[model samples]
Target: MTTPTSCAYCQQRATQLCAGCRSVVYCSREHQKEHWKRGHKRECKCYEVTSNELLGRHLRATRDIRMGEQIMCEAPLVVGPKVAATPLCLGCHRNLLAPQKPAMTFYKCSSCSWPMCSKECEKSPFHLDECRLMAASNFQSKINYNPADPEGKESAYCVIMLLRCMQLKRSNPEAFARLAALEDHLKERIETPLYQVLRANLITFIKTVLGQRDWPELEILRIAAILDTNAFEVRQNGERRKVRAIFPGGAMIAHDCVPNLRHRFDDNMRIIFLAKRPIPKGAILSISYTQPLRSTVQRRVHLKQVKCFDCACERCSDPTELGTFAGAHLCGKCKVGKVISQNPLENAANWHCQLCNVKKSAREVLTQDARLQQEIESLDKTTPVHLEEFIQGHRIDLHDTNTHILQAKYALTQLYGTAPGYAMDELSEESLKRKVDLCEELLQISNLFDGGWSIFRGNLLIDLEEALVAQALRLQLASECESKLKRAEELLEEIKNIMKHEPEEMQQMLAERQQILNAAMAPFSVGVE
Candidate 1:
């Protein structure tokens, strides 16, 4: 009366067995076949090992993993609050749907209608939580959630409360219950900080400058202002119209000098992480949590100043960490080699490359970077319509692989594909091809840095496939067109393998791709070649 084995596919306990592969058991033949077809055909055997637990875990490579293999799929554990902060679709967070007519705006939520494709999207699960909160407020509770602000900033108050909510959800239900109980009154203290110093200054400013009116938009600006003025360190890149103010949650993720993860956001405001490299089992996964090229001393100081934590990560401990004296060059005059401070925890001492007598303070470097960043920001606003000029200007200061340059390239990719006046459709064939070429170039860099089963890579593949298909359609050469069509098909298949769990969307994309391939190959069907 032994218990039956479990089905490998869904991990369900079953009495029935597979007829074809009697070695494996299943609840039904259909599941057995499905499992085999899904590439579980070879991993059906059971084995015994005599090694220690770590050896048993590490030594066994049950199957070979391809570079871009689909390892696992998981829905988000938690999504951000759906308050209207940005011009993104509430459902997917990709940019909002464009209006069909030139003059008319798209549909918005009846309640807040801040930014949405339609009322249908307003009911989406992603919008449910924030919408509920917003509804409870009678639409009066402005969470400082305007995502369309040119500064692309969020209210520190709102962000801090969100973080507090997340922490409470994990630690104390009673405390969470108390906060939830006060949900109605929560809007009143939207200007107050959880910390005392911030709270005192913020209240003073609210009384002095803003008066008593509950201007939600004004409140949001004030929060951003507090972050800009009082937050230990602020980094702003005006060219990008983006500011990265350190958040407690983002800070808690910790740091790794050679980080395995990179992150980006879509229009819907989702934080997506991609694997930069093959992370082996038992590896403590990490993200940089700061700019990668910053010297160890600079990174540590910035983290401690803003995050309120001392980082003793391996890279921070190394004297010549990140290989550039933390990007501080040697002082030729003194010839005494300067290094990142031995005590990174204490914000003592100006940067004096120990070897050279020359010294520069942390304030000096930060001030310079901030000033250059402002110049880049100013240039960014002017050049959105003139991309080539934008690229040329950014190239002068930021290296090709610098983060600023990569950010510029990403913008260029989007503009080339979708920017109305300066899009691929308006460009000549040569220019269109060049745009596609640049996208492909960046895609390669993205793969190198953010490749592991991530939404970023997946979306890039989709974009690349679309561009190739477009190129094939434009070309008159039957043979060249056929080759491009085949390449696109291969890329789509790779995408499917990586995104198989997303069957509904993947199936639709696959069918559309097949249709394009068939259309492209039709002219060559009756060819003599």
Candidate 2:
């Protein structure tokens, strides 16, 4: 395509091109700013949308992207509560307060008879569209406010985001068009039990009670499926407040077991994607829709179930999981050999012992894995004792790099510094050493998978650096103190770079960490007299 000579803003003859995309021309700096604010900013990105047979729609860098470069930041097209969610204010998406007294009722929206925090919430733009629709239809919400079970999931919240999406048909047709253009995989989901529930209950309620009969059942179901396929889980105010929002631009970035990009939400709830590693021009920009620590079988199964595709990514194809053996088990037959899948992508493929060639059926392997996972899950993790015992007990069966062991080790890293009687100051010398060792080991595995400026590596660095600082303070010898403090400084510098894109609170924590490290090093700054 020939570059246009006309300005994107005023359609006047133009000499300047956008530095970011170079696709649009601007007459002047003022026109550039105005054009960007008008919406060119969303279009001006390092990555462009691309598609394939496997990923359907995905993103690729249009130009070389530096490590930690901000790729895209987009506001949600629609935001609402999750389908099955704990009681939260629909207006603000915060957890609702428990009913205080004998009345056992929540503060309801006076207009819609739906539960909200206050009259202020009733007038919120998020609530008004649905409030007017519900009130006009005389639809009273059946969301029971049980004082005893205030934190329990409320099924009534399921209709909220769907209603918001449906409302966009009339309220904002352009947005609805963009939403409708997204891949919903409706055919893949329509027969599932969840869709069956929607068909029986949700469909009837929306069409009959809410009087959306003009909307076809299939079209409404498509919207639900779209939300499932594309929505990003937004966790705010730490992990306490959780909701879901969909960004059309964000939804285009496809999934990989090991992703090149990591995302975080800003205060305005805009989703920002950053390059976790340097990307050559035309490399696919990706994010992990599943946890990195999960075994290949577990991750593949989850991706298929949730994202409607099998991941044949490089990590998934490797039986040794890029030499970490995260998905392999210690062979019961050989007692020394690791059991690995014949083909990591095939669900029904046999697993064989490396030493003896002894085979285990996929069912047997999955069953054993599930039992071990359940055992680990059921163990009390408040203290490190149970986790340590579990790791020790399974050492012969699970081995060092087994997924279960890695998970337990990761948990122990968090528990050692924060759990009761295991605080950084309270930890014994042995436990401090153990925490450092765990962080180092996890950091290596993180490098193999989610490497280079990744959040996982950054978090491990934080843990390792803090432990190093503690070890430095604990040592009486100046040489040991200097060595550990120097290492801590190195780790802190990397942590700052990796987490520079993090939220303000995390940035503040990083500043505090630097101050603490500085205070620790102050004594060492002066020469021995």
Candidate 3:
């Protein structure tokens, strides 16, 4: 990569190439501005794509990155449904509005039978290529609104994304090149059951049914694999809608269990990454590929299955799981000691108890853990009764910070203030104490695993502050209430900083919380003024 010596507009010794089109060289800032105004706006990408030994290809620092800095902002290269169970607009990816009468039907694309929100979306450039292909194939979609099991109505629109990626080869070859460049882990995925199903069904459809057999079978499969390896799942703060999109740059940043970065989406659906903690120059930038609350074992298994690697980060290698002990179980034989994995990184490692020297097979531990998780999933989270019952049942087997119990506690935090029988004011003193305890416990855990102004810690703080404020109102002592309120204020300030990169909805929530705190304090002040 030699630097260009001539300007793109006029032949002169170049000082800068057009950042958007690195191909175009400019000798002066004035020439750069002229080129940008003329046409470079069409291709002004913020980040450069590069390759390395560790990540294959990953986004890297061009300069020193500060704390709370915005690194990459990217729009979706291709967006479509994600394993949808019901009819949703192929354009907007929202659940199709069920008809008022049983005889009525969902809105459909005028060109293709696939669902669409309106005629405008039907005409949208994003949907047109696939729409034309499906319409030409005479493959009418049977997926429609099923009010009986609205969210469970299985759809055949899964192929739409694959088709969109295939269409890009014709529509934009450059983007197709980028998509093709992504690491697909095809060697690993080929043995998986999903690839087998695709081989039998998708291959026939793309080659025979759609009559596009000219495309190489491996290339088609490679595109599908690239999507699986690189795409992001995107949704708004409160929306039920979820769609898949690829941000080439965002896709390149590698994963760390305790990541330095956190990501959020704007209303337009662009992915934005912000530094959760101050990242030093030359340090690898990463984000968590798994949920923050998941135990090391669970995260490792998921990463192995999906990303095709075992995570051996600081959190995963530790037997105590960074002191959270989220994967630890009670030693059934010892009756007093706790059990943990002998090798946290290995799937087949034996479990051992510190006391009594009791040992258990990995199979035995995993099976029991699975059974407990299934039991927890069967319960209704909106009510605490079932969760509490499950907790009580597992009292002997699970420690307080065991993944299952911690999951129950997290669910309880959401249910306490908002559940029908347990609104904030209606909560008994004992229940309020429990909610406070859960939030505090998780906050400490967050410090260990999701530290330094991460969303996980910020959310826990929010829950804890609310619980403290509610408790303060019931306390007779003025000093106690004031002291608790002051802590809540401090937490609120931290929340503001943690959520600076968030969408407008979070800002609104913060404002509402501040008002709530202010109103709560008005009763305490009996000023002379």
**Candidate number achieving the greatest TM-score relative to the actual structure:** 2
Better of 1 and 3 by lDDT: 3
Give TM per candidate. Answer: 0.49, 0.92, 0.88
Clash number for model 2?
A: 0
Worst ten in a row by lDDT for model 1: 232-241
- Runs in model 1 deviating more than 4 A are 1-194, 197-277, 287-364, 380-387, 394-397, 498-514, 524-529
If ranked by lDDT, best first, what sequence of candidates would result? 2, 3, 1
What is the overall TM-score of model 2 with all chains considered together? 0.92
Q: Lowest summed-lDDT stretch of 10 residues in model 3?
A: 95-104
| Poorly placed runs, candidate 3 (over 4 Å) | 1-54, 60-64, 98-104, 237-240, 523-529
- Measured by lDDT, the strongest candidate is 2
lDDT of 1 by residue, 1-529 (tens): 2335998677788767543224566777788789889976554421111233311111121222233332222222233322223344444343442233221344566665445556777787656655555454455223232335433433322332243243444466765443333212223333445444434554444443324234344443434343332222211121111222223222223356555555543332234344445655334445664655354555676755544446676666655553334334334455345434444434454666565456667666456556654554666433245556655765443445444455555666666666656554566676567667766866666554445555456667777787888888888887898899889888888777656544254668777877877777677777656
For 1-529, candidate 3 gives per-residue lDDT tens digits of 4657898667887868665335567888888888778777665543455676656666555444567877778788888777444566777676564333332366788877777778877887878898888788887777666557645756476688899999998899999887877788888898789988887888888889888879888888888788888889887635546778888878889888999888988877899888777776556778999988888888999998888877877888899987778998888887888889999989899999978789999999889888888888889888888898888998998988888998888898888888998999999999999999989888887777788878888888888888888998888998998888888888888889988777778889899989999997887677826
Cα deviation of 391 in candidate 1 (Å)?
3.7
- TM-score, candidate number 1: 0.49
Instruction: Name the lDDT value of residue 521 in candidate 3.
Output: 84
